[model samples]
Target: MVWKPDWVASKDILRRMGWSVVETTMMNSNPPEIEVPLGNFVKMNILFWNCRGALNVDFKRRIFEMVINHHPSIMVITETRVGGDRAARIIEDLPFDGSIVTETIGYAGSLWLLWKTDDVDVMLLSSFEQEIHATVKVHNSDPIWLISTIYARPRLSERRILWDSLKAVAQLHNLPWLMLGDFNEVLSSEDKFGGNQVSLNRTLQFKECSDVCNMLDLGFTGSKYTWTNRRPIFDLILERIDRYFANPSWRILFPEAAMTHLPRTCSNHCPILVELLGSTPPGPNKPFCFHTMWLLHPGFPNIVQEAWTEDGDLQGAILEFVSKAKHWNYNVFGNLFAKKKRVLARINGAQKSLASRPSEFLLTLEKQLIEEYFFNFTPGRGILGTEVKIECSYVWRP
Candidate 1:
């Protein structure tokens, strides 16, 4: 039989899980500003994805989620399989301000650069069968970057042609240059696992290509391997075919840049993120908010009554109320935000545990915590959004 639970039961379940629904806050009397939006400026996130032509309905949604979560300034995609009329639609769905795409020849391979729609002035220098070369200047920052993305031809002879052409392209401009994509080759043996040993001759060719281009290996931080054959463990193959390489000038421009291989949940190849951090300027202070959720507790009224006794005037009374409200919250509530953090941590632990042993009880607990997390994601919504219609009822004594 399926189990159903109401909010009351869910609350009891949460309490049993060690996180009570009636959480309180130990707030500051001076009302410290909310420390949100840790980063002041929007740093550039460069993402390269070899999607391998799986542009299902969820494909676009997944892309949107990645974009929203990481806010990449420049996004590069390969093997999109979308062509002609459909390519435009795909670009439209991207959160980035604009994009440039390479031609798709019968759904074989395609390359494109997507950038923030505004303050992005990029000129397409050249486009080829295997690559697209462009110069990008964000907000006239003077540190212009020449970017080239390649989806190399699978054949060895054809790859030689691509390497030679790329060598010529790299020397075309003296600016900071970044080269990235699915080269379909490995530079080192460590790049492959569960596969036949990579040939010395193949690695030599790839190394020689990098030498000719003066490209620095912007090594990755996440999964050691970026591509998998999707076969069973015994017959499985994994290799780091996708890579990000840049010239010395590029490193000089963004010294703290890093590339991380994000987990591959739905694709053969994992998407790599190249983070180019920028100077973060100071942001303005956040305004104070009055949380009506506090009022739900019986002590809230007592604290307000004690703090609201008229001072010299209305302004003084309000000042006193604000001061005591903060003090009372600190003394009485015992840190509400900390409670949220603990609840989220418990939820994470429950999720990991459920993976090993699935149970209806754990599922219900996870669902409850998820709801709790969302509520905390947007604090004090009880008094914020119009969804909460507040009504004041008057009791008449006759």
Candidate 2:
């Protein structure tokens, strides 16, 4: 929910009055466009890390708290060295209602999905190349084709197999899809800070994978890379191997979503934070006034009292005052509240326009607003201290 200055004042007042306003911001302005109402727009956090085989109690608790603080609608983790059973035990202890784990022994297996059961509807259709890919339906929305994780092999031939598997899944679902995780292969030279010496085979394999999936590579945000090697000369050397890909649909909800490189934990690679725009909520009707400060005028009380004496109702009195008030500003507040009604009508019309469009388009517009307007809308930046970053597409190529 967008926090306005008035809302902050209201919150402060409520706190002073000893009222606990647990929910300060509403999730969405209007209901989901689907036939049924999904409680609200879901908030999700996709985390990618190579957790170097350590899952202590303290570590588990810290991770749990981190997830809770973010309050993601869905969560996905990668490079979990632990087997599925052990991962399940850790996840089971958390507050989330459901989790799906897929693990392979030693070399390159990963955990795919861990989501809140109440918000998502899961239908296990078929496995893709023995990977745990699923067709998931979100509340009151169309199904989202999802694959938990992808572990690209070091060898070109093996990577080709993985690519084919992904293609098979895409053909099977034939819907909007997002396949994400520790891909382990950098697509271009820009992906790695200083890895020009590394063989081009892996990069070529990554390009092939992208081509087969018909995917657009959304690059990382904060840091140049996620993975790191130990050699001092190349000590801080990092590579943007971990990534995410979306078909047309997933991009709708999050056109601006990008990977943020987080501080490293027990893993060699820093965790990646994929951020998306939250949905807007329908707002209350704008307040009406005959003049900006009409209520503060000394003559208003007597006029209101006389109107009430005649009409015996608050609304009727207000109507009478509007009709009788001399030199009233129609532009600010019309005699018939027609302007207020028109504003409300405009809001309704915008909502209808949003609802009729495809979910992807609506989501893209929302992302543009957040990145361009909302996130950058800082005080002291623009009018009312809000600024919007207008440029739409930004890319760093190698």
User: Per-model C-alpha lDDT, please?
Assistant: 0.66, 0.51
Ten residues in a row with the worst lDDT in model 2?
Answer: 383-392
Query: What does candidate 1 score on TM?
Result: 0.61
Model 1, global lDDT: 0.66
**Candidate that scores best on lDDT:** 1
Residue 65 of model 2, lDDT score: 38
Q: For candidate 1, write residues 1-398 as lDDT tens digits.
A: 11122334434443443322111111213222322111123267788899887376446655764664455778888988776667887788667667788888776887777888575666666677788777777674655567888899788997888888877654433456899999999998877766688989988988998998899998876667777675644555778899999987777677778887765544678888887873244357322324445666578777667655544555555556666766876686555545654765676565444434446575567567756655554335422110121211221111
The RMSD of every model to the true structure, in order and in angstroms, is 20.9, 21.0
lDDT of 2 at 247: 59
Clashes of 2: 7
Error of 1 at 337 (Å): 16
lDDT tens digits, residues 1-398, model 2?
11132334444543453324221222123222223222233445556555655364335543553463344556666555566576777777765676666665564455646667776765443333224565566675543445445656456676677776676444332345677766767777766654456668767766776777777666654445566563333233556777777755566556656656554433556566666543234257422323324454456566555556643555555555555553343433334234323433343333234323324453344334433332222223321111111111222110
Error of 1 at 273 (Å): 0.9
